[model samples]
Target: MPMKLYGVSDGPPTLGVRMTLKALNIPYEYVNVNFNKGEHLTEAYAKLNPQREIPVLDDNGFYLQESNAIIQYLCDKYAPNSSLYPNDATARAIVNQRLFFNMGFYYSSIGAYALAPIFFDYQRTPMGLKKVENALKVFQIYLERLNSKYAAGDKLTVADFVLITSTMCLEAIGLDISGYPLVLEWYEMFKKEQPELWEIAKAGMIELAEYNKNPPDLSEMNHPFHPTRSVK
Candidate 1:
């Protein structure tokens, strides 16, 4: 059976999973879920991902959700030679920690500061862009520490994929990558070395910007990451 990725076109997590698969040269079937039409809210997609999420990966009969977990599972199973997942226990633990942090701090901040404001009903008084600026300042600090090439250094890992997709959201929200030197370095490296993977994210960036610019009527958007989600 071909590996199938059920995801919305250009969605963040979906983009991350697709990039990982491409980097590993893994052949998979792309199942595009129409976010504009509430396709992901359907019962079938919910069954594939109890979270009612995108980037649900089905390898043979085994299924996996959550972008990072899907990336790890595929790297360990199909791309053992790929540096996307570290082998050492301690180093692997570090990657897990940062990955968790990305989900918590990185993604949440961007959603609140960037996506929520423009897409969602996240209205504020004189603090619209401020929300994103503050969160990006925190990311700048993290990037200062994490600015090194690759996730764990020299070799690209799943950590890079996670950050790349998340940062794409930041840029979509007008967060300037150049403001943070280290993050910009990593960004340039990906642009140069993994041009193909970068292109995937680049496509995502453009669509999201346009969508957010003229957001559709998402009356059925119930997912946590929907553009009109509550940001507190």
Candidate 2:
């Protein structure tokens, strides 16, 4: 049986997984879990991921949650020798560091500062925006320090797949990416080099931006990420 990916097309994390899958030329069945339609909230979906997150990968009987974990597993299991994930300990460590940055800082900053206000119907505080700005500044420094074309290093790894989507989210949400010249250059080059994945990134970015333009009545729905609805 082919692997199954459960996610929506317009999610940043989901797009990252999709990019990784395509880059590795791995064939899998996409099982859309449209959160907007409350599909992900169903008990059936919960069986696959108790966290109720998208981008769950089901490879035969084994199920994996978290986009980064899924992508790494794909590369490791399907294409162990692929440079996109590297076999070298030091090189792979760098990629792992970048991926951690994305999960713990980069994407989290935007999710808190930008997406939170839009999704939860709250005003974005200056402090929140400052956190996001700091993340971008650090990202720029990483590029300049490493002097590499990609996030982790010179090679395009799983880190790039994850970072690029978050970067595009920053751009789509009207964040000024112009200040980070290196990030802008790298982002453009990544898109140019992988046009197919770029389409998915572009679509997800546009979808996010457009949805936030006139946010729907989320009051009727309870999201796990919502401040009041969050699980303790």
**Best model number under lDDT:** 2
TM-scores, each model vs. reference: 0.85, 0.92
Query: lDDT of all the models against the reference?
Result: 0.74, 0.84
Counting clashing residue pairs in each candidate, in order, gives 2, 0
Candidate 1, 48-138: lDDT as tens digits: 8888777799888788999889988888899776557778887687677767767787766665665555546765435645655555567
Residue 76 error for model 1, in Å? Answer: 1.4
Candidate 1 accuracy as lDDT: 0.74
Off by over 4 Å in 2: 217-220, 224-232
TM-score for model 2?
0.92
Candidate RMSDs in order: 3.6, 3.2
Name the Cα RMSD for model 1: 3.6
